[model samples]
Each structure stands twice: as structure tokens, then as C-alpha cells.
Target chain A: SQQGEEDPQALSIQEGENATMNCSYKTSINNLQWYRQNSGRGLVHLILIRSNEREKHSGRLRVTLDTSKKSSSLLITASRAADTASYFCATITSYGKLTFGQGTILTVHP
Target chain B: DVKVTQSSRYLVKRTGEKVFLECVQDMDHENMFWYRQDPGLGLRLIYFSYDVKMKEKGDIPEGYSVSREKKERFSLILESASTNQTSMYLCASRAGRRALWGQPQHFGDGTRLSIL
Candidate 1:
């Protein structure tokens, strides 16, 4: 079963604009993480936000978690063509299982 | 920096043939995992190991078995490769002991398996 579901399966934006993706999970999570995958490559870790943390940031990435709602959102500021790829939200179980979402394909037009 | 390496980026196998996919990590991390990704359905876990000689079944493990004979290497075995088993296989490692959560996982480039 999928633990997380990402909204807006595909998004197209121009460079220098902001892109936001939302994710919702079914069960409680120990932590939630965001990852970026270039074409035909492995995913690269972006940021990790614990259940207790409502918001966290790393460079151009911002992650906000709402435990009460079982949802999270990722915000990428000043998008670039380099950021054109699939973004995934993974929910970590207490037992260390990482279940990834369907992913949102973001295309940034330069 | 932690590095996870998959044995192959592409593989082709015939139905009923036994196949093996291997992954290695250089960080000596205690946690390793195997997952398969398909379109419309995200990445689904197949197996995981917390330490050498230890294996645990993930959500989908019916057609797969895992081997963890050494600390740095984890292998996924397809007892009898099937058409449905063709997908992108990913291996990931985390820096946690005893299967604790909260740390980010490092992933290999992935193996795109095609079973005929």
C-alpha cells in the first residue's frame, strides 16, 4: 500500500518561480523526507522533518509537516531548470521502513 | 559522503530464470533496503536488513528473497523471474543501528530489470 500521495501529478513552471507540492499519508510517521530524482538516476535526499517539527528548511527547500492532519508540503523557492525532475515524499515508519509517494514531475522552463 | 552502488543499471532476463540484483554501500551503514518502483504505484519495499545475516520482509516479498551475508553488500534474488517482476529496482542505505528511524537514506542509481 502507498503511504504517501502527492498532489498535482505534474507541474510546469518557469525558472525563478516558486513550486509547491503537497503530500498526504495514511498512517503516522516517525519522520518525513523529500527527495529529488533526475532522469534515470537515484533519488537525492533534500530535507527531513520529524513528526515533532512543524517546519524545516534547507537552502532552497522548505518542508512543513502537519501531524494532526497527516499531511506535508514541500516548497522550492526560486526554481531552476536544474530542479526539473521528479520530486518524491517519503514517509518513514517507526520500524525504519521508507514508503515513497507517486511523485510529482516538475518541469521548469528556462 | 555515503555512497550506495547498484550492480547494474539495466538487466534483461527470461521468464523462469533465476536472477540476482546486488547492492553495496561504502558507509558501513547498518540499515539497507530493497524497493521496486512502478508507474502509477510509487516505490514499494521488498526487503530490508538491519545487520549481516539478518533479513526482514517488507510490503511485497512474495516473489523475492534477500541475502545479507556481509555487512556492506545486500542481494535481492528472484527465485523465478516473471514478467510482472520487471520494474526499476532501488537499493538504499541509512546510517542507523537496530533499525531506528529518522535518518535520511542514500540510494543507488537503480537497476531497470526487464523480464521476458
Candidate 2:
């Protein structure tokens, strides 16, 4: 069973614009992580937000987690064509099992 | 940098044939995982190992089995390859330390398996 579900299965935005993707999970989590994957490639870790943390930033990426709401959001500022890829949110269950969401395909047009 | 290498980037096999998908991590991490990715189902875990010779089944372990003979090597075995087993296989590793939940998993390039 999938633990997380991402909204807006796909998103299209122009370069220099901000893109936001939301994810909601079913159960409590120890931490939430965001990853990016190019077509036909493995995933690359982007950022991680612990249950206690509400928000985190890494370069041009921002991640926010709301434990009470069991939701998280990823924001990419100043999107670039190279950022065109699928973004996924993974949640670590209390038992240590990691579950991933369906993912959000973001297209950044240059 | 941590390097998790999958044995093959692409593989073609026939149904009922036994297949082996190997993964090796150079970081000496103690945690290794195998997952399969489908179009809309996302990535589903097949199995995971926390240490050498210690294995656990994941969400989707029905048609898959995993082996962890060495600390750095993890292998996924298809006892009897089937058409439905064709998908993108991903291997990931992470440090097995305190607060393992806080660390991120490093993934390999993945293997696109096609079973006929």
C-alpha cells in the first residue's frame, strides 16, 4: 500500500517561476524526504524534513512538513529547464519502513 | 561520494527463467533495499536488509527474494521470471546508524528488466 499521495499529478511552469507540489500521507512518520528523478533514471535526494521541523531549505529547494495535517509541500524557486523531472515524497513510518508517493511530474519550459 | 552500482542497466529474460539482479554499494553502508517502479504505482519496496544475512520483506515481496551474503552486496532473485515482473528495478543503500530515519538513501541508476 502507498503511504503518500501527491496532488497535481503533473505541473507545467516556465523558467524563473516558482513551482509548488503537495503530498499527503496516511500515517505518522519519523521524517519526510523529497527526491528528484529524471526520465529513465534513478532518484536523487533533494531534502529531508523531520517530524519536528516545519520547513527546510536547500539552495533553490524548500520543503515544509506538517505533522498534524500529515502533509508536506515542496517548493522550487526559480525553476530551470534542468529541473524538469518527477518529484517524489517519501515518508518513514514509525516502524522504519519507507514508503514513497506516486510522484508529481514537473515540467519547466525554457 | 557514495556509489551504489547495479549490475546491469538493462536486461532481457524469458518467462520461467531464473534471473539475478545484483547491487553493490561502496560506502560500506549496512542498509540495502530493492524496489520496483511502475508507471503509475510509483516505487514499491521488494525487500531490505539491515545487516549481513539479515533480511526483511517489504510491501511487494510476492514474486521476489533477496540475498545479502556480504556487507556491501545485495542481490534480488527472480525464482521464476514472469511477464508481470518486468519493471524498473532500483537499489538503494543508507548508513545503518543511530537515527537511521534521518539519513537519506542513495540509489543506483536502476535496471530496466524486460521479461518475455
Candidate 3:
């Protein structure tokens, strides 16, 4: 079963605009992670935010986690055409297993 | 750099034929996993191995079996392939808790299997 659900099944925006995706999970998690997948490519890990951390930033990517709400969000600043890909949020259970969301398809128009 | 390699990028097989998907990791990680990605259902874990010769069934292991005879290699076997089994299969590996630099799972370029 999937542990997280990403809102806004699809999104489109002009280049340089910021994109935000939200995710909500059913159970408690030790950490939450975001990944990006280009067409016909393997998933690449973006960032990881632990339960004790509320927010974290890496390059143009920012991730926020709210343990109380069992939710998380990923923000990509200054998006580029190359950012046109599928984004997924995964939660790491206490047992150390990773559960992924259905994912949101983000399209950045050049 | 950590590298995970899958044997085949694309494979086509007939229904009821036995299928074998192989995965190898260069990092010598302790944990290796197999996942299947479908259109609506994101990525679902099929099986995983924590050490050599140790295998565990994941969420959807009904028609799948896994083998871990060597430390650096893991294999997923389908006793009888079905059309529904056609999907993108991904392999990933990660360092165990004992590693100095605890890293996230590294994935291989998935194998797209078509059971006709």
C-alpha cells in the first residue's frame, strides 16, 4: 500500500516560476524524502527531511515536513525546462522501509 | 560513485515463460530492494534482501520470488510470467546502518519487461 499521496496530479508553469507540491501520508514516519524522475529514467533522490527537522534546503529544492499533520511539501525555486518531470514524496517508516506516493507530473514550459 | 546495474533495459517474453531479472551493486551495500512501477500505483516493493542468502517479501510478493546468493548480487524470479506482470522493474541498494556515511538508496536504470 502507498503511504503518501501527492496533491495536484499534474501542474504546468512557465520557466523560472516556482513550483510547489504537497504530500500527505497515513502513518507516522521517521523521515520524508523527495525524488525526481525524468521520462524513461530512474528516480533521483532530491532531499530528505527527518522528523525532528521542519525544513531543509538543497540547491534549488526545498523540503518541509510537518509531523503533526503527517504531511510534507517540496518547493523548487527558479524552475527550468529540465525540471519537467515527475516528482514523488516517500516516507521512511520507523522500520526503515520506504513508501512512495503516486507522484505529481510537473511541466515547465521553456 | 555508487553504481547499481540491471542486466537488461528492455525484455520481451511470452506468457507462462519463466523470467529472471538480475541486479548488481558495486557499493557492497547490505540492503537491496526490487520494486515495480505501474501507471496508477506508484512504485510497489516486491522483495528485498538484507544480506547474502536472506530474503524478505515486500508488499506485493504474491507472484514473485527473490534470491540473494552473493553479497553484491540480487535476483528476482517470476515462476510464470503473466501479462499483468508487465511493468517497469527497478532495483535499488543502500548502505546499512553501520556504514559511516549513511546514504539513501541508489537506483539502477529500470528494466521494462513486456509479457505478451
Candidate 4:
């Protein structure tokens, strides 16, 4: 019973293009966070949007959250070959534990 | 600059053998988590600890166990390694909201374990 699930299992685009990944979760949450993983390494936190916040931005990364729909989307603009990685969305429940989505594999070809 | 460190980058173990994966965080975060990553299945949580000597089971905690004997250390244990258990193990730590507004977690490189 995974609480979060991401759409578009795999995505490919040219460098400098914009990539968008969406995540949907099944329960009430306090916050949602996005992370990026390179190869098989640990995840690097990218951005976090609270349940009360509708959108957030950090550099070229933009994240939008629709708590009413229990969904979120991450947009990476000006994608680079280095941006090729697995992206995951994690939901933090009121109980304090995080449930992660399966993840979306994004490949930015040079 | 929070630093989370894993003991090994890669590990190999024979089936039925015991395995231990260790993680340490320098920021003294109160929450620590252990997860295993596999193809298609993404990352599955094995266990997490909110404080020393406290542990909680995650979604897939069945063949695994965990220990948090110290504030900055968390260890994942496998009683009997199996081929199915071979995957990349990741550790993360986070401080509560008091420190910052939704502080992001810090992750270690990871331990790639292969059970033959």
C-alpha cells in the first residue's frame, strides 16, 4: 500500500528543455518533498512544499502542490545532461514518517 | 553543512549470512531512516528511528531489523541475507521543524549490497 505514486515512469528530453514530473499521494499530509538520485546513490533533497503552500521555486526548479487533489508536480527548466537522474516525491504524514513514490527516471540527452 | 555517512560503498555476502549496514549523521538530527532501492520498485523503507533506542517498522520491514543505540548512528541488520535482499541501501536524517522551515533531509552515498 504505497501512499505516493509518480506518473510517467520514464521521460527523455533534450538538454535545455523543460521536464515535468507529477506525483500523487493517497492520504492527508503535512508536507511533500522532492529528491533526486544519481545512479544508485542516495537521494539529494531538492525542494519541499508544505500542504499550505501552492507553489515554490528554487533556481530553475519549480514545484507545485495541490493539496485538494493530493498531488504535486516538479518542473526542471533548462535541463542538463547532469540533470539526468531518478526523481521521487515523498509525503510526510501527520505521524512524521515519510512515504515515497516509485520515482520517475528522467534522461536529458546532450 | 550536514553530513551523513555510510560505512561501505559496496558489500557482498553469501546467502544465510548476517549483514550489517551502518549510517552516521554529524548534525545530530533526531530522525533517521533506512531504505532499500531496487529497479522498478523505487526505494522501500525498512525502518526509522526518532530517537536513541527507538525504532519503528517501515513499509517493508519484514526480513530486516534496525538499531539506534546512539543519537547520531542508525544501523540496519539482516538476520539472513538472501538474493532478494540485494539492493542499494540509503540512510537519511532530518532535524525537526524547530531548526528550520521544513528542513530537507541529508542522505549518505549508500551501500550497494549483493547477497549471493
Which candidate's TM-score is highest?
2
Question: Per-residue lDDT for B86 in model 3?
Answer: 99
Better of 1 and 4 by DockQ: 1
Candidate 1 residue B85 Cα shift, in angstroms, is: 0.8
**Who wins the DockQ comparison?**
1
Candidate 3 RMSD to the real structure: 1.5
For every prediction, compared with the true complex, DockQ reads: 0.86, 0.71, 0.56, 0.58
| TM-scores for candidates 1 onward, in order | 0.96, 0.97, 0.96, 0.94
Candidate achieving higher TM-score, 2 or 4: 2
**Where does model 1 sit among the CAPRI classes?**
high
lDDT of 1 by residue, A1-110 (tens): 67899988999999999999999999988889999999889999999998999999899999999999999999999999999999999987756778899999999999
Model 1 residue runs over 4 Å out of place are: B98-100
Worst 10 residues of 3 chain A by lDDT: A90-99
Provide the TM-score of the second chain in candidate 1.
Answer: 0.97
Interface RMSD, in order shown: 1.2, 1.5, 2.5, 2.4
Query: lDDT at B69 for candidate 3?
Result: 94
CAPRI quality level assigned to candidate 4 from its DockQ score: medium
User: Candidate 3 has what TM-score?
Assistant: 0.96
Worst 10 residues of 2 chain B by lDDT: B95-104
TM-score of chain A, cand. 2: 0.96
* Candidate 2 wrong stretches, greater than 4 Å: none
